[model samples]
Target chain A: MSAERLLWYTAVMAGVTYLIRVLPLVLFRREIKSPFVKSFLYYIPYAVLGAMTIPAVFSATRSLVSACVGLAVAVIMAWHRKGLLPVAIAACAAVFVTEWLMRML
Target chain B: MNAAERRQAFKTGFFDGLPIGLGYISVSFTFGMMAVEKGMPAWAAILISFTNLTSAGQFAGLDVIAASGSMIEMALVQLVINLRYALMSLSWSQRLGPEFNLIKRMIIAYADTDEVFAVSSARAVGGKRLRFIYMVGLMIMPVIGWTGGTVIGALASAILPDAVRSALGLAIYGMFIAIIVPPARDHRSVAVVVLSAVAASCLFHFAPVLKRLSTGFVIIICGIGASALGAWLFPVPEPDCKPPDLEERSAHEC
Candidate 1:
């Protein structure tokens, strides 16, 4: 891509993204009063995280087997109430070990 | 707030963002490599990462640029892929402390990536109001990590090891799991909301017809649907309670 073209596209992408992010923060200066809206907003982060993780997590590693192993380790450790760092590190470690073992086999 | 309190808040946010910044390096490294592989200049790839600061949206936009797609196509793709940020920004605005004004909101909105929003919203949900300087502190590391990784990857994609690259894919998802699981375990309503959203996402991913939808739409649908379900089933008590605005309101009648 030409430098000019790339800059144009990047500007458009950034503009659209910034608008999406900025509009809400700029517009909604007051607290929203609706119970349902508040409840929906409250639950949104969990809902988003859930939707982002599933099926996508299964494809995160080089192989599905390793990915599943990683997911299992992550879920178990997270379920045990481990901190974010340990859980993330454990999942990566599980995927690494699983891939190494598979390579040997 | 005094200088000491300001420093403490910044330190806390900096630490909170440290791991997230590390994760961004891995992801953005791939983005930079791919953009270069597609015949983009290394500087161009770095520029995209520096300005956009989004993961999936940038990836999709890279495809559009590589294919020489139209400007409208680029904007539409970004709009769809990033619509979730609008929802997050709405929630985040409600959680902002009195320190947040229009200027700070504009500046802070630039760093409202998925992981940042996740961390900030988690803090807000814990009943703490988000402050302006703390958010500025939280944004610094991830921005540096993202841009730095892109520069390195675009210039040295061939030098990185395959093993490290492959293992890095799961880091962000693992982080996501860590964020959601503890809360789900605590509240049955949250658990139901999360599980339902996951189920819906799976349907969109694998089921006939629905599987054709783009990832952006899939996420937006599942998130809003499941959240609406939770709202209908379990409305939050005292939704009018503004934690940041009124201190006495904490003890006020619901």
Candidate 2:
């Protein structure tokens, strides 16, 4: 892509995303009014989060090993409910190290 | 509410996000490395980190670059993928500081993320000032980690191992586990998460119609579809908030 084009796309993305983030504040100050809208909004995040997180975990290989390893580590951490920092470190380290060994063998 | 309160939110928001910063670094570091591998300059990669603060968008954008997508394609992908931020921001707008000026609101808007959303949502029902604080806690560390990771990855792309790179590819998958699995043990987010993922993947792999879709298109379609369904079925409130019964929630809900 051309430099101008890339910059334009970046700017547009930033602009659109910003607008999306900001426009609501501009329009809905007190609270969203409509019940259906409210009901729909309720599921939107869950749906989005579900959509975003799911494909990442279980596509292509069907091996839950990688996902499971990361989950087990995270659950242990979040359950004992240690700090997210420690949990992240432990989890990322475990996954990376495990992948490393797997690759080696 | 007051200057003192705003200051408090700032401090808490900044500190609260510290741990998330570490995770952002590892994953985003890999992103920067991949950008370099794909021929993006280090500055470009770092700039992307500073600006986008999104994992999926960046990864998809890189693919767009690889495919030599048109300008329209690039813009549309970003628009599609980042559309949720608009809703997130809108939801947040209701809760964040009422006194917030347009500029402040605009500047801080893109700072919303999953973690930021979590923290900000916690305080949203109470007041704008508190929401702002929660947002602050959520972002301070991520910005540092993300920007710093880009620079490091861009610099060390050549040195990073394939094993590590592959591991990073699984970061999203790992996160799903963290989000979905525990909930499954009970009867929780497991169904929605599992269904959405399986549905999308199956579509991507088997559904002939879905095969023609770009990465951005795939994400948008799957996200919008699954979220729409979950929304209809589950109907989480606009706020979707917990009623501050922390003790009860902690014991049973998660």
Best-performing candidate as measured by TM-score? 1
lDDT value, residue B69 of candidate 2: 77
Per residue, candidate 2 scores C-alpha lDDT tens digits across A43-75 of 344444445554544431223565457656766
- On a 0 to 100 scale, what is the lDDT of residue A14 in model 1? 92
Question: Candidate 1, B250: how far from true, in Å?
Answer: 17
Candidate 1 chain B, poorest ten consecutive residues by summed lDDT: B245-254
lDDT of 2 by residue, B9-36 (tens): 6666675566556557667887888988
Docking quality level of the chain pair in candidate 1: medium
C-alpha DockQ for predicted model 1: 0.71
Q: Supply candidate 2's per-residue lDDT for B11.
A: 69
Per-residue CA lDDT of model 1 for B1-254, tens digit only, reads 79987887787678667767777887899899899899999898898898889989999998999899999999999999999999999999889999888899999999988889887776564356887878988899889989988987899987767666667677777778887887787678889999999999999999999999888889899999999999999886683432332233222211
The lDDT of each candidate is 0.84, 0.59
Off by over 4 Å in 2: A1-9, A58-64, A76-83, A100-105, B1-12, B63-70, B122-130, B158-208, B211-254
Candidate 1 has a TM-score of 0.92
Which sections of candidate 1 miss by over 4 Å?
Answer: B239-254
